[model samples]
Target: MTFQSVFRWFGRRGQSTVHQVDQDGQKEFTFRAVALGLIIGCLLCFTNLYFGLQTGWISMMSLQSALIGYLMSKFLPTPITAQENIVLQTTAVATGTMPLAAGFVGILPALGLLEEDRDGTPPVHLSWIASVGWSCAVAFFGVFLSPPIRKQVIIEEQLAFPSGTATAQLISVLHELPPPDTTLRQRRGYTELDTEETLNDELSPVEPTELERLHEAAKPEPEGWSSLTWSFLASGIMTLGAYFFPVIFSVPLFGNYLAKQWLWTFTPSLSYIGQGIIMGFPTTLSMNLGMLVGWGILSPISKHAGWAPGPVGDMTSGARGWILWTSLAIMCSDSLVSLGPVISEIVYKKLLRRSISLEDEEDKEDKEVEPDDRLVPMKWVIWGLSGSVVFGTILVWMVFGNEGIKPWATLVGFVMGGLLSVLGVRALGETDLNPVSGLGKISQLLFAWIQPGNVVANIIAGGVAEAGAQQAGDLMQDLKTGHLIRASPRAQFYGQLIGSFLSIIVTTTAYTLYNRAYQIPGPSFPAPTAYVWLGLARLLRDGDLPEKSNVFMLAFGLFFGLVSAIKTYASQRQRWYAKWIPSGVAFAIGFLNTPSFSIARLIGGVVEYIYYRQVGKENGGIRLIIIASGFVLGEGVVSVISLILRTFGVGVASCWGCAHGMCGGCPS
Candidate 1:
């Protein structure tokens, strides 16, 4: 079937129901919406877990869920309003985050890997009931934390929760506003959203304005929708082509020999390009720069100098092993340092009973707060947070108390999770990325000090932070959607709670079933991030690290911290100069992944720059963001397709052919 036919099929199904509005008027929350949200959310939850195990990444699914909700709304018994649509997508997003939040794809699996000598045996220490209850309680507390910070970030600070904003726009355009072909927008005098000046980190400074402004921003012309449709289809096709015909991704630089050794393949993955667009120029450039410095320069030198004992591509004793410490150092230090002040400020204001907004804002709207009736009351937060913290701590202590995690330590973790959640929200607001894993790692580091070499304590502590940060970030993003649509915070919060509750039972069952079917860390299902978690645990337990690396790691960490500090300072004092500084976290990510991936990200960054220069969005042209969204969705589609294909034994999914020279076992 052609792409046009596919678009037409969706278009035919995506229309709003004429009977949607009754005389009493449609409600913002409904049984039909919640039911669909649960159904869709459960599917996405399983897929996310599967994807995370394979690729060490999990994507937020609000946009995709929203898209699906749009197409499926026609089948619902009662039609959903745009506000109700937020509830549906919010539920789906919350459910989908559970694998990572509950540690099925990270800490819990890592514990098993640590015990089974990487052979994928289940952890004897784990109890199914305890884990489920604890995970539920932990994720439960995260929902409460979002309400306290909603006004500060969304209203006064005006942080751009990009994915939330994008999803909000999508819902408004699809359900709330008139169709793009109509004259209603002109009649209402709704103007297009003007994107503000981007921060150094690519955060667009947009206010949480009225519902109409969001509609204007998201509503695309007919041609724009066509562009979005085509970009999405093309990206999916390209992903498939790259997989089947490796030649598409095997473009070489500086001849086959050097290119192969240097990992210089120009794999033009549209997914990476879409990421680059969302991640922005500075961050993507830093990733490429790190790839060059780490792989292009350091790897060759380390091998010849006998600093690394394994083969070039070997992860354990090669450049990958030694360099990761430095990467971890830079990432950890920068994340903490960059986020500390904001957390401190939030705390400082809370203590003083002072308003949290910065002193520079002039707009009356900036000081406005959502009515108390629409907001989540403090009583709910108190009962919810305390109840869950106490519940989660008891269960966690019961499960791992024998392993040296005292109940006090568990409480500390829950408390720390509440604090670190701010980091996740701030990062998501700015970058459309939540550094949950990073937050988790930091928690692990703290527990290393608190409990001192108890790997169980470290993992559980990390899990709490991971769960809290992810769920908190997810809620805030949904609330951003609610903010745009005039949905009640209390209603959305309850919808989020329903999803979180569902996730515990659904995700745990999915993981258990998948484990019985295959070796988790084995070839078919390499829970890659689990290995990172395992490594940290080993380092804590046995200090099993390579020699001659501490000095390098320390030096790099200090350098990264210094530069990050400068960047933070510059962002406030020297705005122009801040753009010139590389993001330490992004740059350090080079050591975390393959060389070719960074190069792909660089291609994306360059494409975005070129797009702005040439097309210019001159006088409200086709939406570039729609194309970016398409690329992301298309990539997700291919990932699911790829997973299914692999399940049926499509191919080994290996790269036998390098950009320069094909290996002897390659197809050619």
Candidate 2:
């Protein structure tokens, strides 16, 4: 679509009838589907908690959950409708993404003790119930804010919501029966009367009978079932084999040996490759560029200039600390600039009472739709928002006030969270990025100014804002998927609510267990994001800016970020310039992670690009996505299992220390 046409489509407020509606009106929000979703959601939440602590990134489980849910329905005595599968996936996404909001999983645990050097100082202890309560309240507050913007963003704005779109496609394909070749139809007990001629005759300007609808629904399984099943098994076995080589057999080459010795970073992770494929070329390329700049150039320059200590125990780890600060500068600036148009539009339309556009009489007719198409009642939305505010206020007071945070400051933070959530959702809608860390930094600066010298208040307020924004952006993406598939908004909302509650409980518990097993910021669990948050909070609280050289680097990063943001914004209008503008956030993320991971991701993106060119984008390239999803699912499941086994001191990797280049035999 042309830019103007696409813009108009997004700006048009109306319900969509893009997909085929279910004729049977079957049970979509059933007890069975929800139970299955909850089970899968909890599993995903646990794994995400573990993985996020390990890698500083959370894996997307929507596609995996959809495939598993669909496979389960197929093997069961009674099959679920496609709508039911969508609901299941939605719930799974809600829970799977919740780890992003949990303080322990993301930031809280890395704070460690307020006074670690003191003889009897206790560790930073956040009560499980308080964590769960605050997270749920903030997440629900985000959910409550989503319905009002659903029409503007999803229907009118037509955001891609990339993951959600992929899940919807998976649901459609898995639920569809094989195309009716005459032979195949006949074998499935279809009569000659069920042919196209008879079908047309039965539907000639008259309502089809129930029997006709039943006949339509009675088809064989999808044509690609064999390919999907075989691919899934093959990928799983491959992942299992790869997992054993480096871990069990002490094979250096299969792990990070090549990277350590030669700097040829190649991660043997199919899951990372899949993620790269999903992230696409622009993001992966930007990340690689960041890695090159941060480690290849900046680190060496800093060491030569006597600004950084020479070659530490872990060079990458030390360099990452500098990169983290640089990234914060870039992310904060880019996020604020990117949010300009969205914030302006919201203010103009809502607060200023200005008409967004002039609607013609014919346009009014086109916009007319049934009330049944609406997802949720306005009354429910109001009540939910009100309840969230009251409960959120109480939770904030009870949780933070006990630690000497002022009630007014807590209230201000809650209000700021709601405002930031609007920006968060808009950013996600526009760019498929949630600037949580940037939002947190912004919140921290704001709260530091409001409540100076109170580190507890600063951290708590910032956490609340970040958590709210992250959850809000995530839920809106889920809502977009629901809108696309014609799922009930009310049903999706309830699923989200249930999923969020379960996720808070499950992830918090998992975090506690994992923390006890392997202390965070130690050798195994780096918790890099948490470290960043803790460092930032301390810096703001103590008014300790970086040294002169580091400040120059930060300024350089800020300038680069501003230029990148401008180019990106300009490229939207001038599509020809798009290839020249890289994603700043992707670059920042690249610096935050190991170089090997980014290299693997880039390779995956290259593979995907070549495959797309060969197959053509319109010629059912979704099959490739399904295969990638299989690889991700296989590796992720195995990784989680490995971690669980290691928790009990069973099946620990023989090369664990060596793989990380900590052993004497390995290169530093």
Candidate 3:
């Protein structure tokens, strides 16, 4: 069947709904609308990249893009005048590209030891061709892998697709706004909603049931606009200020102190939760507590000091530590966790819930599924996994373990890393396994066994660790969006592929330039902690746990799991407590990472909460959300660009004169 016919079969391709009528009183999904959204998405992506390079907040891309997209729709005339179309496409691009970009730029160059041909050039480190080629290959694999996982996480587990939901919410609201009415009524002024209905009536078929459903669906839901607006703006101001004036403007208290005291901190402090919230005492306390757990309690005290907890460490060490290790564990564990839920959904629904769908289907046989169809066959998942492994192998081959490291050697590393990851996942399943500790142990072993310059070996090991952890967290979230929207696995896969491939190219070029301009540290920056892990492993081989090592992670994990179970149970009995508990946990996690991060989370949360409490409107809430999106995209791109610069010896911090300028004013 033709693409148009296929879409029509899905009930998605039809005349524009009454809520989507424009000034011309026309109604139908048009190419113009889709094109408009694509254009906005592209522009927002570029703007985000520009700002990310200029500043250091990597996560600002989503917020920035959303804000910009909303503003554009509000002010400019587009083929698709609805808010939902604009925001959804824009955020899809921004959110999907971030990690792919960051990982490509940071990991590829570091692994390849790619250096520029400058005066007294650092002996031809990594080849550009190899790095880029490897990136494309990896992109292809990630594109394929990310989608299936996303579906499993989203469709099966039914977790919140927070970011996607935020974007979709914005777009849906905008789509529903009544179009401007032109024809004057005989009795009075022109009517607004009637104009929209009149336009919609001409284009749509006479399906009474569908029309009723559409009308009911079009009704606006209550939203928290004012609170969201203030919080978004406040968070943006705090983040921007911290990025520009980190040292001088210290994020009020703890984040600054942590950055100052620590040798490496991931993500800056201004990006944390408690940055500038004088009124958010509960939020502040939660975040600070989280910081104490993540950094002081976890990073320093746990066995995984090999990888610093936050963004900076990930950047500094090429993520030789926990960042990678934990990510891999998360991925595998989540996949395992999601399996049960997904099977249940398919079986129970297929066997039982068929009557509801079957009766509907009887009226319409040969119906087509949309590209956004969330349900996926198991076959595609198997293909995705095979493809992921193949691409992962290729990634290790060309870019990372490039310095004459044997393929066999790298495979060994992968095996070791994978085994450790599995162990960590298993432990975390039943009990909390302080994943970093497991990562530290494995990294320590490799450090002792694999010499420096064995880039391929290290890269493979690193990939296993990182992917594992990231997959664990990401699988559920992506899957949640898939379940809600029913986005096709292929579409999701390709979307990620497009994102990853493009990001890799962007990352490589930007980082190369940044590294060249700055007289920063060489390709051989210290992996002090990584080596420390190596030493520890040797001691373990000789038989002895470090005197200061804490093995209480399992206990902690169990305790937290119990707490989570209790909260989940309580939430069923008292919905208010459920929301509050989750909010509190979120706040704590934010604080644990960086004060700035915590601050941003709190702002987003409060904005959402307050909007729900007052005015019962959605437009303002969506607009504010878009504003947050703008900031997120803007900062994320800038940071990605900055990383590229650093890779080339052009110190982004130095080039920008951050030591004395706004960037240097960080409290820590």
TM accuracy, model 1 = 0.76
lDDT by residue for model 1 over 318-416, one digit each (tens)?
766667666767777777667754566556655854342443323435453456766779999899899889888887777766564788888898888
Error of 2 at 543 (Å): 3.4
Q: Which is superior by TM-score, 1 or 2?
A: 2
Cα lDDT, model 2, residue 545? 44
Best of the candidates, TM-score: 2
TM-score of every prediction relative to native: 0.76, 0.79, 0.53
Residue 400 error for model 1, in Å?
5.6
lDDT per model vs. reference: 0.66, 0.60, 0.37
lDDT of 2 at 660: 45
Q: Which 10 consecutive residues of model 2 have the lowest summed lDDT?
A: 197-206
Once fitted onto the true fold, the runs of candidate 2 whose alpha carbons sit more than 4 angstroms away are 1-24, 59-64, 113-123, 127-130, 155-266, 310-317, 347-357, 360-374, 396-401, 549-553, 574-580, 618-620, 651-653, 656-660, 663-668
- Winner on lDDT (1 vs 3): 1
